[model samples]
Target: MTRSPIITVSRGRFSSTATQVLEQVRTARLASRDEIAAATGLSIATVGRTAALLVERGLLRERPDLARPGVTGRPGVPVEIDADGYLVIGVHIGRRIATVALGDLTGRVLASTTVRRPLGADPDLVQLSREAATLLGSCPGRVPLAAGLVAPWREIDLLPREREAELHDLTGLPARTGDHISAVAAAEFLHRRQGRSEAGGLTLYLYARDTFGWSVAVDRGVQTDVTRAASLTHFPTGADVPCSCGRTGCLAAAVDVLPDAARARILGATAGSVRDMLSPDQVVLVGQAFTGDPALRDVIVEAYAASTALADPVPVSFTRFGSDIQAISACTVALGPVLDDPLACVELTGVAAACRRPVA
Candidate 1:
């Protein structure tokens, strides 16, 4: 068994053997005190006192069936975290809509609402942010401690920072956005969950809406915690299809379907689009393109096929969970914090060798 090494918890908040045990039992699901002590390299007495204090804080619990008699060769008790401790908000800002979901530490959606809005930071961006932020305004009697906002794919680099503070400030619930990709997180999380091991298959996620992103993960029979991926919307994939990015022939350059003019009318594109990118196997495609139109789905597949890089790998196909993947992806990112330990309850694992291949 791969023994999870005990590590320090809350570096400045509460640093001790107890805090370590608290974090582990709550997240890793270690069953007993001996298990905790062995993992921490701490003495049994310290483990006991620390556990007692945690029980008083409503942070830990002991299993009755696992409880043992006094030196009678009986089964011992197992302890775990009491999960009903806090609340968190997972906000997914999509091109056309924003989904806000309230969850516990275990990823349970206490309440959720999906709202649609215009795009960009001007009046639209401000409205989107204001509406997205309102989900937290109506607290569901739970602790309104933190909210995680997952903007559309390209905005990953737009999160305010030291220098970017001049860009704009996002307030309410210690929120900050960065280069964290939802496709990447979902892929890795799935690889760990279903594969039964650390390394196995690959996971490919394509956000196939107004704005798009792609991610791939591979495990050479070993589960991968890291991935090689990109959110590729910087330029047009084809030469003539219009895009929302205010350019022609960017991603809007090709058409296996209608004429570029016709596609532009339907796609509401800013550039001429062509089939440029291809996804690896078990590729999970999100958005209405797949569900609403069969021909559009075929076009997506064929467009992928036309590209040597995207078509050659022969990956399995997966679909997005909700209407907007960003919503669930946002859930995946934000919900992790609410649970005592997310891995125990949620099946965030995936198959082996997810997206590994020689890009054709």
Candidate 2:
């Protein structure tokens, strides 16, 4: 909302040596400089310097307590994300409800609450901002760095720069907005990086609920440049349901086309068709359409399996976060700046003072 340089990192345009080191430590949860160097192809000296910078900025912590007992050097000391040092606010404006959450550096949700939205009403920035502030206030000692707002693309017109500015004005924090689908894809990307580096390939993320869309992540980054998810709402699903477009079988219209089993089959078949067209290396299913009912989920899975064209099955999985994906995705966007450039974020957000306060 403030158009700060730090907030623009959500656009997927920035990365640095510090980001590389921080990301390695985050992925491993704990890694020595040498381990980071090995994983990132950076020199040990570079890793040490970068790790030191990150530690000084409060994005990482030196874990001498976890050092190898018999070893006695910097390489013996591991560093991990300093999860307690700061917080970010995540606001997800959905069709019927808005969720506000406080998240730690490690993408853990600290606190969250939902505010219901009246049918067909525009989101109330003032109300959502108050909710976000309340969440942040609940965490006594935590310093909030930024806020991220996400909504359906159709809703994007309603949340122009003015809306973002309103949220920033109300909450006293820099705020940025992003497409909900892409944010969810980024969250999934971060989740995959937890224990190991993601294998190199294209990943297709399919989402459904009050809206329908898909997003793509190429290796480590979500494809933010592509913003055509809203167009998928009109994809033909071959069902005889009426659409606002004066056509039948549109994906959005097919959602309520018939019996639960038929709906599941149509959704699954639609997903498979998209997957085949993209030929992605993997597929991840998310949103209430996929998670709300077990029977529907099973039917969709069967239909998807039958629709694939490849001899070798592409790996398909459901989001582990389930209904919590919305909040987590928004948090991931808010955390983007820090993850992209830790030292810059500290300076930009004036978080340096908070970093100096001793941790309890």
Candidate 3:
């Protein structure tokens, strides 16, 4: 049993003990005070006090039947996330489309809307901010704790720091920004209510859409910082095609000549390069190419085989999320500060990999 450590919660916030206790309850789905104490290494009395505080905050609920008498013969009730009282908003900014969604405290998407906008081309931060605010306003859910915006790192980095404040002002809620790939990874890790993702150990994420890109994670956390200019758009693909970057035979340019299946294979091969560089335990392919097209999915598997021609090839899988992955993930990233404890939760899960922590 891993002993949960009491971590310092920031000032003017929930106490360290209460935060850790609530996290244990959320992670376990439901837990009695004794279970939380056992998992977190806090005293039963401490867990009881903290649980009381969490319950008062509407963050947790007590299960009367699960209650058992403690050493003093007082009933100890099990608690779980309230799930109905809190919400998060996520915005996914893509080259061809943008989306805004509302999610519950359990990370379930409750309402969402899609708008056609070329975010990758000429990004109008002001317009996009207004659109996101409007979309969020139209949705029905609990008031969101915060809103998260996700775009390609290249595109997001172009926005000045003041852009976050502008977004908040328009949306009337705190707002945060992150790379699309990292947002996808966070959604995969934090919102796995149905089943666990096959992504474990060092994992590689292959993304295909308006641009060719990828990101890496170990254990559920992104391996790179949001400020890192990571991209695979220009990697050579040995083709004679002209690229938008004025280069011939580039990966992004190969789309004109290669079939979807071939493109999937090339993506798999590119994933292999990451595997060689980091030796990940698994590779996950996300986006429309893998999930929407069956032929392309099979082709990507073949590509994975060809790419890992060497000994000890890593396994590969695909995300079950549909088109809304980016939007839902952005919400998770926005809620990351609360869901994913920087030092305590990471240390408990044993993933300690680094990325930009959420502000809210």
TM-score of each: 0.55, 0.89, 0.77
- For model 3, the superposed segments whose C-alpha errors exceed 4 Å read 1-15, 65-76, 119-141, 192-200, 220-229, 340-360
Q: Is candidate 2 or candidate 3 better by TM-score?
A: 2
The alpha-carbon deviation from the true structure for residue 195 of candidate 1, after best TM-score superposition, in angstroms, is: 8.9
Give each model's clash number.
Answer: 69, 1, 0
Q: Which stretches of candidate 1 lie over 4 Å from their true place?
A: 1-83, 122-141, 153-158, 162-172, 183-197, 200-202, 216-229, 234-249, 252-283, 287-314, 335-360
- How are the candidates ranked when ordered by TM-score, highest leading? 2, 3, 1
Each model's lDDT: 0.45, 0.77, 0.61
Q: Write the per-residue lDDT of candidate 1 for residues 137-252, one digit (tens) a residue.
A: 66543443345555543453343233113213443343323223553245234423431322335555544455545555444431233233355454444466565666765432
Models ranked on lDDT: 2, 3, 1
Query: Candidate 2: misplaced stretches above 4 Å?
Result: 1-14, 220-230, 357-360
Q: Report residue 225 deviation for candidate 3 (angstroms).
A: 8.9
Q: What tens-digit string does per-residue lDDT give for candidate 3 at 1-360?
A: 321111111111233676667656655777788877876678999878767755655567776756655432332567787776556667777777877777766677877777787444645556655665566566543445666676774644455235556667766655666677766765664444223313245556677666567666544221222222256778887777888789897877785578776677777677667667667667777777567776677777776787664688677788878677876776775665444342342233222222112211
